[model samples]
Target: MPLDLNKLDHLIAVAEEGSLTRAAARLHLSQQALSTSVRTLEREVGVRLLERTSGGVTLLPSGAALVEDARVLRGVAQSALRRARRIGRGEREMLRIGHTPAVTGGEVSLLLRHVAVTDPELAADAHQRYPGELTAGLLAGDLDLGLCRGMSPAHGLARAVLGEHRISIGVAADHPLAGRESVALADLSEQTLVVWGRPGDSGYTDLLVGHCRAAGFEPRLERSTLQGTPPVTHVIGTDRVAFLTEPPGAAAGGAVRVLALQPPVFVPLHALYAPHLASTNRDAFLDAAQARASRHA
Candidate 1:
């Protein structure tokens, strides 16, 4: 028997909500009905999917893996329907691009400008999304492409490195290192590092931390209180220093100074997309981006 899409959706809901009651409420179905659907799905797959406990439900390894693929399947179905409707209406295709905060709006615009030079007729839309949201949007077919730095693509997604950006250091104008033209990794050993996300939780953060560790010191990391702001701005009012890609200059109205990193470190800019979905616009944009990156290299 073919796997039922509805049953898969039910399982996804249960996995997300972690409780049959809540999942059923969200789906507007009775708890018993939702439970039965999940059980049926498990039986069809010939494996136990969930572990029931007094607290709530937890996904077994197989269930977790199935949920990942189920999301991709649902997205493919939705994308197919959307494409059919667009074709029926004679609507032109527009590439939808989502990017994480780490990539910055300026970077996206720069890439788009490069794409325009190569494919002037391609219509595109770009917006910033959190890392999780970016992944979900790509998996749900809401975004045709996603741009990020150091983000590991989730299941059902593929990534390509477009290019690398040099890392710089940012410090408040009044900070001790503000007068320096450039600073080595060892110079930051004693300074508290302001990071956008928790060290272990964000791949970008981990990459930065790894650099610091390689320099022979465990970094003292502080999560920035100001979220979604430019990395250079994170050091504006604090005594902390930040790893930034922002060009060297006075930022936050001259409150911060951006300095070059000696023995330069670089981070890769990656493009993420659902490989199974074919879009001429996406292909064109990627090709243009790669060509531009090659020229820069």
Candidate 2:
């Protein structure tokens, strides 16, 4: 038999809330009624999905798997509804794109211009989103494409390397390295490297660190307290140096100086999207971006 979406929603609520009583309250149902619904669902599925205890409830392996699928199913349903409404209203198709902060606005605009060159009629809406938000939006069908740097694609999404950006160093104007025309990787061995995220937590940070290690130094890392700021700005008030993609002299009111790395390091620009969805506009954009990247290469 086909699974009931409402029951799946109830199970998700229980899983998220961690207590049947709380889940019932959130669902605006009595605890007994909610319990009965879950029991019925279990019977229908012919499996025990939850472990009951005085403290709360815990999902069994089967239940945990189902909950993960349930969220994706919910997102798919919402996406279908949205598409249907748009089609019913005779609205033009708009490609929605979300990108993480690692991808600058200038990079996005350049890609859009490339798309315009090939497909002038394609319309796109792009915005900045946190990494998690970008993944969730893509899975939910709210975003047709996601652009990021060194981000691993979440389950149900496909990723492609559209291009790469040369990495540069940014330091405060008064810093020792600021007056240099180019800074070598070894020159930064004594300087603290400022990064946006922790070493193990961010793939981009880990990749940069790996480069430093390759240059014979384990970098001294400092996590920037200022969130969502440009990479160059991270070194504005500190003596540390930051890895940035900005061109030389592209700093906040000249507070920082951008210098070329001696042995150039490049970070990949990746594009992610749901593989199950068919979007010609997304295909067109990816094709154009890849073509431009190949020409530049």
Candidate 3:
């Protein structure tokens, strides 16, 4: 029988939460509505998916089998959405684009504006990610276009220089260094550094740490964290210091101040895409990226 995506999503939520009540909360439905849907789903399939107990709902063997299928079905649907967005925009059969958050906000808005003026049919969907993930996704073929930082262009993909900017230091308004319009690593010698690091084996963390050492101090790296800006945000109120891209257009949360880095360290912003794209929109997308970068420059 053809399965409903909503039904599959509902079942997965129940399985993950281990209770109809909790799953209902997650799904933003009342307990009664969730229970009724679960019952209806079971009736449709002629099986008992859950057994309610004092602890909560427990999925039966039949439900367990279907829940696994639910994940696969959802993945297929997301791919379909991406593909539809790609084709609808007048691009080719498929185009997956990725870029770091730095390049994609105002820069992205500008790109879309250009597409409206120029290539209305260039239907490319852009995904935002960090430096390493964007590159890894490009190499893995799940992504067709990418914007990355720090890494040099690889062999298989064609690259163009978008622009360059420095990674700045972010701290709380009351912090000692916040008053400085620009700063050097030596100026921060006596203060605590709230650094984001690759806790285990993250190559990105290693890159940032190496820079810290060059500045003449070892950072008190945030522990047990994955790569992202939250660790940087956490250090704001404390003695810790967080690194950032200078002159950031819009604060990710609109609360932090973007500092200027003195003796500006240049980081590459690249526009990457699969060399095989047959769509005429490839150059159009590059044009969009260049225009966007120019606006920032």
Pick by lDDT: which candidate is best? 1
61-154 per-residue lDDT for model 3 (tens digits): 9998777556555655655676678779975554457866445344555556665566666666776777667755664456766765445554
Candidate 3 to truth, TM: 0.52
Runs of candidate 2 exceeding 4 Å displacement = 17-34
Q: What is candidate 1's CA lDDT for residue 244?
A: 84
Relative to the true structure, candidate 1 has a C-alpha RMSD (angstroms) of 1.4
Model 1 segments beyond 4 Å from truth?
Answer: none
Candidate 1 structure lDDT: 0.90
Model 1, 125-232: lDDT tens digits are 999888889999999999999998888889999999899999999999999999988999999999999887786678888889999999889999998888877667
Candidate 2 lDDT by residue in tens digits, 59-98: 9999998887777787788778887888899988898999
Candidate 3 runs further than 4 Å off: 1-95, 101-107, 110-122, 130-136, 152-155, 190-220, 223-234, 246-255, 277-279, 287-297
lDDT minimum window of 10 residues, candidate 1: 228-237
Comparing candidate 1 with candidate 3, which one achieves the higher lDDT?
1
Alpha carbon deviation, residue 276, candidate 1 (Å): 0.7
| Candidate-wise lDDT, in order | 0.90, 0.87, 0.65
TM-score of each: 0.96, 0.90, 0.52
Cα lDDT for residue 23, model 2? 99
